[model samples]
Target: MAARWLKVLAAAPLMLSALTAAQPAQALVPYVAVPAERNLEGAGLGIAQAAARLLRIGQADDAARLAALTVQLIPDDPRGWVLLAEAQLRSNQNEEAAVSLAKARELDPKNAGILFAQGSLALKDSRPSEAADLIREGLKLDGNNAGAYFDLGNAYILMGKSGDALGAFERASKLRSDFWEAINNQALVLYEQNKAGEAIKRWRRVVGIKDAAEPNLALAAALNVAQPGNTESLQRAAKALAEDPNYVLESWQKEQLWGPRLRSAAAQLLAQPALKADVERAQANAGASDDLGDG
Candidate 1:
C-alpha cells in the first residue's frame, strides 16, 4: 500500500502537466453541424457529419435514428447524446427522447451535454418545473454552458414563468454576452409580464448586440404592446413593420409564445379603427401562426 501511494504521489506532477499541456484553459472542442467535414478532433465528428448529411437530404427521420444509434454506440460521449436528443425532438418523439437522454446523464453526470438535452426534453414535454430544475443543475455544473441556459429560459417561457425565464436568459447573456437570441427572448418574456419598458430596453440591447431585423420587428411589437393606443407607438410599430425584410411575421405565428394575452392584445390592437390605415399599410406585419392553450 505504501509503495502504491508513493508511486501515485510521484506521478501526480506528470499527470498535472499532461492535463494542462493537452488542453488550454479554454481549448475549443470539435463540434458543429458538420464536424466530419472539417478536420476536427474528438468523437463528435461521426455523429455531426451523419446528421449534416441527413439534414441536407431532408432525411430527418434517418438522421434521428442514426443519431440515437450513435449514442447507443458511444454511451460515454456527450455529443452523441445531444445529437440523439435533438433528433428525437425533431421527430416529435419527445418522451422517448428524454429516456435516451437519461442514459447520457447516467454516463456523464457532470457534463452539461445531457443536462441540456434533459432540460429541453422536459420543456418539450411541457414540464416547466422539471425543465427549470434540470437546466439549473446543468448551469451549476458549468456556468458557461450556453445551451443549458437557453433551454432553461425556453422552458420558463413555455410555462408562462416570466421571472424565472428572464433570470435564466440574463445568466446566459452574462456568460455569452453576444447572444442576441437570449436578449431577444428575455425581452419577450418581459413584454409578456407587462414590463414592456424593460422589454424594449432588452430588445434595444439586442439591436445593439446583433443589429438583427428580427429584433427590430420584435421591438415594434413590444412598442405596440407597451403603449397600446399611442400614435407614437403605432407609428414606430408601423415603420418597423414596413422596413422589415423577413415578410414571414414570426410573432403572430408564435402563439405558443404569446398565449391569450398576446392574442387579446393583437385582437384589440388590430381592431382599432384609428390604426386600420397603418395596419393595412403594414398588413404584412400581422404574424398569427400558432395558437396557445392552457398549459
Candidate 2:
C-alpha cells in the first residue's frame, strides 16, 4: 500500500507536464495546416510538366491544355508561361504564344529563360531577322544569356553568314561550358560554310546531349565529306534520313533559313576539298616564285 501511494503521487506531476507540452503543440496545429494547404495549391505542376513533354513530342492539343492549366495553377512562375508558349507553338498557335511570352517577358524581362522561348518561336516563324533583334535586347538585359547568344547564332545562319554565327555560338559555349544548344548550332554553321571537318569536331563536343537530331545529321554529312569514303558517310546519311524522312543536307539554310527562293547549298562540304587543294597549290606556286625571286 505504501509503494502504490508513492506511484500515484509520481503520476500526478508527470501528467501535468504532458498537458503543458500538449498546449504548445495544439497552438501550432493551425500553423502546420496552413503550409500543408499551400503546398497542395500548386501541386498540379507535375502533371502539367508531364503533359507538356508529351505535347513537345507532338501531342499538340493535349499539351496546350496542360500548359494552360499550369498557368492557372501557378501564374507567377515565369516557367509556366514558357511551358504554355512552347505548347502553343507546337499547336501552330504562334501569334498567341508570342503574345503570352511578351507578357512573360514584361513580368520577367531580365530572365534568359523567357528569352529562349521567345526566340525559338521567332526562329520557327521564319523571322530570324526579328529573332536576332529579340535576343539582342535580351543580351542588353543580361549579358550571360546563353539562350540569346544561341538565337543570335541562328539568326546569322538564316542570314547566310556562318562566320558571325560561329562567333556568337562560341561566346555562348564559353559563357556556359555545358551549353549543348550553342555547340550543336555551331556545328551547323560550320557545315554550312563547307568546313565539314570543323563541323564534325564541333558536333563531337555535344555528343551526349538529348534531342540532337540535326547535329546527328550534320555529323554524318561532315563525316561523309571528311574523305571520299563511302560506307560510313552513307550509313550516317541513311540514319539521318530515317530520323527525318524529309531531311535535306542544306535544306534549312537554303529554304527556311535564308531567302525566299531557297538557294542551292546542298552539302556545302563537297567544294571544301577542291577549295583546300586550290589554296595549297596556290601556296606552293607562291613559294616557288619566292625561291626564284630570292635566287
TM-score, model 1 to reference: 0.61
For model 2, how does the per-residue alpha-carbon lDDT over 1-295 read when each residue is reduced to its tens digit?
A: 3354345344534433543455555465553323233443444466466666667577766667666666655677777787788788877789989987987887788886677677778887888888888787777778887767877887888877778898999999999898987887777666666666676787777866644545555565566554543565555544544444334434433443432211232244323443344334433443354356445
Candidate 2 Cα deviation (angstroms), residue 80: 5.5
What TM-score would every model get versus the actual structure?
Answer: 0.61, 0.56
Model 1 Cα lDDT, one tens digit per residue, 1-295: 3354345345534533543465554563454122231222233345456665675666566667666545544556666766676677776777777776787677778987678678777777678889888878887778788768888888877776778888878988888889889888887777778777887788788878776645665665555666667775455455555664222233543733654444455555555666567667655444332112111
| Cα error, candidate 1, residue 85 (Å) | 2.7
The number of clashing residue pairs in model 2 is: 0
RMSD to the true structure for each prediction, in A, is: 15.1, 19.3
Model 2, position 250: C-alpha lDDT score: 44
Q: Count the backbone clashes (under 3 Å) in each candidate.
A: 6, 0
Q: Which stretches of candidate 1 lie over 4 Å from their true place?
A: 1-48, 52-59, 68-79, 157-161, 192-194, 208-218, 225-256, 259-264, 272-295
Which pairs clash inside model 1? Answer: 252-287, 252-288, 252-289, 253-287, 253-289, 253-290
Give the clashing pairs for model 2: none
